[model samples]
Target: MDRVHLNPPPAADVAERADAHSVAPLLNCLLREAAAPHGGSRDADGRAPDDGRRVYRLRGSGRLLRVLGERRPAEPEMYVSDAWQRIGHAELVKLVADELRRHTGLSNHELPAEIIDSRNALAALLTARARATAPDDLYLRSEQSLLTGHPFHPAPKARGGGPVATWLPYAPEAHARFPLTLLGLREDTVVEEGDTSALDALGEAPPGYRLLPAHPWQLDLVGRELADAFADGRLVRLGTTGFDTWPTAAIRTLYAPERDLFVKFSLDVRITNDIRRLWRHDLLKLRRTDTATAAALAAIDGPAAWLGDRGYRTADFAFEELAVLVRDGLRGRVLPGATPLLAAGLVEGFEGSPLPGAQDPAAWWEAYLAQVVPPALAAFADHGVVLEAHLQNTLVAVGTDGMPVQALFRDAEGVKLLPDVSRAAGWERLVYCLVVNHLVEIAGALAAHHPTLNPWPAVRRELARHDLPEIPALLSSPTLPGKTNLLLRWTGADGADARYLPLPNPLAG
Candidate 1:
């Protein structure tokens, strides 16, 4: 609707905006994973459609579809009853299920509900945004500014189809901030790795216990499971934190600017592709992955930094359920006089976002490419560390003039160690996350705002400078792997298992 630069529109417009927001990503997934360009590739003008209105064949049903916009496609219509009829979120979900079932020879009873739930969630977020005051701090506003997340997922905002009142108070999109639920875990049952001393500063514990700060929403979701721990001596309820922590774009992660710390908590709710929980497998390997990523970012010669996971602490009885990861705050790593903003927010746009109105588009884009691309490439090439350099995992810090000065990457849970997987597999994963998922979205957003800018040439030049052998082949690959989230959900594949189909490589142009 807008550049994500303003609050939710007037009372009259929330549903329409919400519908548009919800429809864009669903259409994006269908077009990328299930639909093919129908008729001819070009419009009647005999040129590529700069306006994102294009028709597609639903591959499975061979039905014709039209949608507006490219980066975040919207305004879907199905050619039905001898006419193109516009469809709402519900109709779109039904059509998507039918097409996916026909194409994949599978059925997902749960996914359609998720698609609708995502739409409902957006309506709630938009309503909440209309009432709530956005944070004055640029970074906080950026962190809370994703109206539509995961530009190419079917149901990115679904929250287990839960009631809005239950989750809205904790949603990042609503500019939510609240005190953490403080609990004391008995010293005997406090399973911890690395230094989690930062948690101790948030609250106090009695003689026999260790302090643990938890997301209040997560506590609400798992109170029944944790009753035994609280009833017995294993866990004791201390009061809530005296200060509030703002939820970052990753809903479970809360940033306490007072202490300059971020604590990532476990949520059993499924958001996007996976249940956003601190599973035992990922938690156990957290240290090793965080270590490698930290070392790689340290060696990379630039302002680029890694927000390392300091450690984790939880009750041994409910380890995965209650675990909390303490992470390094931005005070130290972020360059002085620079404001760190979520890279995804840059694409989604915020009130003060520079991407939309960059005065020197070429210089702005080149500086962005220079800061973001080098560290990710270096991490893969020099250290065998493939950081999940996707948009959500990255933060680009800008100086006073709103020019990018540094890039910081996080989420060690998503990192892939090279030798653990084959070199080929590792490279593929790196390319998908870094190039397809991260840079392409950013470039699209930038180009949409500044049409004259050809974002890919700068990307190509940046890659050509990299020393890695894979860079040469990457530059010439005709297509890049575009993840098939829609098909993955329809086929009931493991959330961790990524399936890919090719999308034309923009850089190869």
Candidate 2:
């Protein structure tokens, strides 16, 4: 393991935090997807008794498990031999694997390793962070603030089990900023669409080649596969970019602050639910989906903005492997005098976070709902465009007072158009992404900080203002569709083909 340590924090401190980080999401998965609360029906509101430890029953094994904390479970203990035994990170992994094997009647050799890798990644990040200088920019700081990565992912920080040194230098959590490896693709073999004019400014290309900026990590992963292209002069290395680009929360997407542009590249590494690659199939239809989302958002009232996937650049032979997608930067997208922060980052707080110090949590919650809810609802109701407005996909810009003033949505590849999928199916996906994944997590974070604030009514009020037909049932429904990442991975389900189970709808008061 490669670690940077100057005035290093105690090794025990790093290990402890890593253990807690690893356990929380895994426990979240077990609680949501594979287990039932001890005694009667699973608690919808997650109300535990005075000690702050909650008991659960692993349905497959009938094992009684208890853990401390609600949002991020820690100090896990399991009932054994008529006694409770505390389990460490290693034991917890083994326990989870055994339970999943029994529960799904399936063995997953890969996910366990990925989960371990995620922990290892965290340890490395913690070590680097102690010595690394955090960025001064509030927005960039927020983007890189997700040290724990996806709150619900079993192995959110797994970097394809690659060498830690190889990926750590590019990790957002480490405040990494590096120059891109510039490649010049032969003009005749260059494949692209939409406005990629921003790419040319990154670096210069020779007479017959187009400027193609490749993520160095991606190149390292696939260089052997493209030996023919390089040897035959179809792809030429033209050195590196003169300036540095910071890796955002999405490790594959690098934001060049100097250019005020975002360039997403194909890293053959899995980040979160999918391999962080700009797939050709998605790229082929990028314009159509992005155009629809852009048009729908523009037509909606208020300050919602869509950061369209302007275009992609790739080689015909190594299209998917060498691809890069360009997206709109914050220059003109956000409202004037506002700082756009990653909405997901709000849940996973940083030093300058407004949520913790908010003077009026109720007012803040109302403003948050106002910025985030309308666009997704309007897009679905008016234009039949379902925006994947999950926490990671959305950006909330806050005014100087730290009140949210605007919402910006991105990732056209995740967008689904109407009639392409039935209205019912589209609505379910919208509800799951926008309400379940996005709002529920943020609300929990907000309420955790401000115990007196009940964030749901404001959410309900904001949502009810929308005229979507599904709003009535959605408000009254007892459960919302929650994507089962844990079971899906265990059962070898396709990543894109989501399978969901019922989660208590916080909106249904």
Candidate 3:
């Protein structure tokens, strides 16, 4: 697999802190500076500079933080900070409390303070939408995922407000202000990248301060109005949507900050177009699109309506950015008896290798194929939606006994349905994304999980057992499976070899 280099956070050195409380003064000073104008300036290279040297880069998030004073500024990169070395937990809490007070005028007790301290603090706070009452608006709901390991999800609000716009994290530098959303407060003030509505709301700066909001794209998702009514707080504000490129432009929350959910919203119009595209494939397209890859989820979502009724929770549909917000799953608090199958470590590993275990390769392989794959198929079958059951997209949580129990699928963009009931009708993209890109991951995982479960034979058997069309003939046919063999190159086997087999394309029927 190719390695993708992630841009690191701004540098902070551990040596500079007396305790976590030290971060408070730095945050206060930075927020104060962020609120002022001209207190900071762009360097010769158009970067924000401090004391004749570039202290930070102007990010899409609008606000700036100090890069390590030790590194040369011209490099234009994010590195670790020196202050973190000396900072203690007590001071960090104090700093966060002070900053929250400055922004929302509320204390730690009134808000989700513990969340504000987590790596995904900004995302969790923002994706939390105020609930709405109107039936039409109820289709939308705020979604959240973890940014890092921690317990935090914004407290559900009691009153109604507008839909949630976006939530993310924020930090500021001396004389420059950044939005609380950057720090992870739910914000609707800024509508686009580099927009500074949070600063505008703060009004005029005092003395040498300049205020800035986090970058617009940093936000997770725009909450449906229904969510606002349920969560009330002064910090949550509304912003204008000016983007005209697409009908109902929405923010899609992708994985970030080591933890976080990812979500994608489709415009009402776009959903219509997509549904049409999907229906063109086959009359059974819709049914195939909604079913789960693992038989386990199918059982739970199907005959197991009891699970959701009993305590196992499920949401109807997830918005893209909201997924990015709460992808961490209530700040890493997995409910009792429920396991998070798609954990950070598992996900990162699954991306490169399909197999689940580093040790006892043979046993791990059998366990993955037998235990993991069926639930996915079940989930999709029960839902009547062909889910993208691929490894990167699905999270199959197992119980203490190592048996699969729960299935969590992320990335709404990959979910598809038939026109009969889908908001997104005719959308082949969902089918391609979920069934093709996603389920392929499952196949890879099976291959990686065990050598005995050959990709070709396993795919064929699984497809046949699920009652999907075609098996032996497609493998012998010269065109389709042959193409896949060439494209995927199953473990270096020749496309024409007996080793290469085919699975029924539910869409083909």
Best lDDT among the predictions, by candidate number: 2
**Stronger candidate by lDDT (2 vs 3):** 2
What lDDT is reached at residue 113 by model 1? 91
**Model 3's TM-score against the true structure:** 0.33
RMSD of each: 2.7, 2.8, 21.9
Kindly indicate the candidate among 1 and 3 with the higher TM-score: 1
Q: How well is each residue in 1-509 modelled by candidate 3, as lDDT tens digits?
A: 11222432222422222122223323322332222222344432345554443333222223333322321111122223422122243443443345445543444452223222322222223222111111111001111221111111121110112222222221110001122222223333211221123223323333323322222332322345325422643123333212111100022222222222221222121110121111112212222322222233434522111111000011112221211111222224333564444422242242222235445544443444444444444444445454444443555554555444444554323444444445232223333333444444444444545655544444444445553233344334442321121111212333222221233353333
The order by descending TM-score is 2, 1, 3
Q: Which stretches of candidate 1 lie over 4 Å from their true place?
A: 1-12, 41-52
Measured with C-alpha atoms, the lDDT of residue 454 in candidate 2 is 86
TM-score for predicted model 2 compared with the true structure: 0.97
Any idea what lDDT model 2 has?
0.89
lDDT by residue (1-509, candidate 1, tens digit) is: 12333454675588788788888888989998888887555543345556667888889999888888667777787878766688988888899999988998888899999988998899888888777888888999999999899888899899988899999999999888999999988999989999898988887799999998888889889999988888887888898999999999999999999999999999989888888999889989989999999999999899999999989998888888899999999998999999999999998998999897788988998899899999988988888998889999999999888899999999999999989877888889989998999999898888889888888988999999988999888889899998988888888888889888899999899
lDDT, residue 137, model 3: 13
Candidate 1, pairs of clashing residues: none
Lowest summed lDDT over 10 consecutive residues: which window, candidate 1? 1-10
TM-score of each: 0.96, 0.97, 0.33
Error of 3 at 339 (Å): 3.4
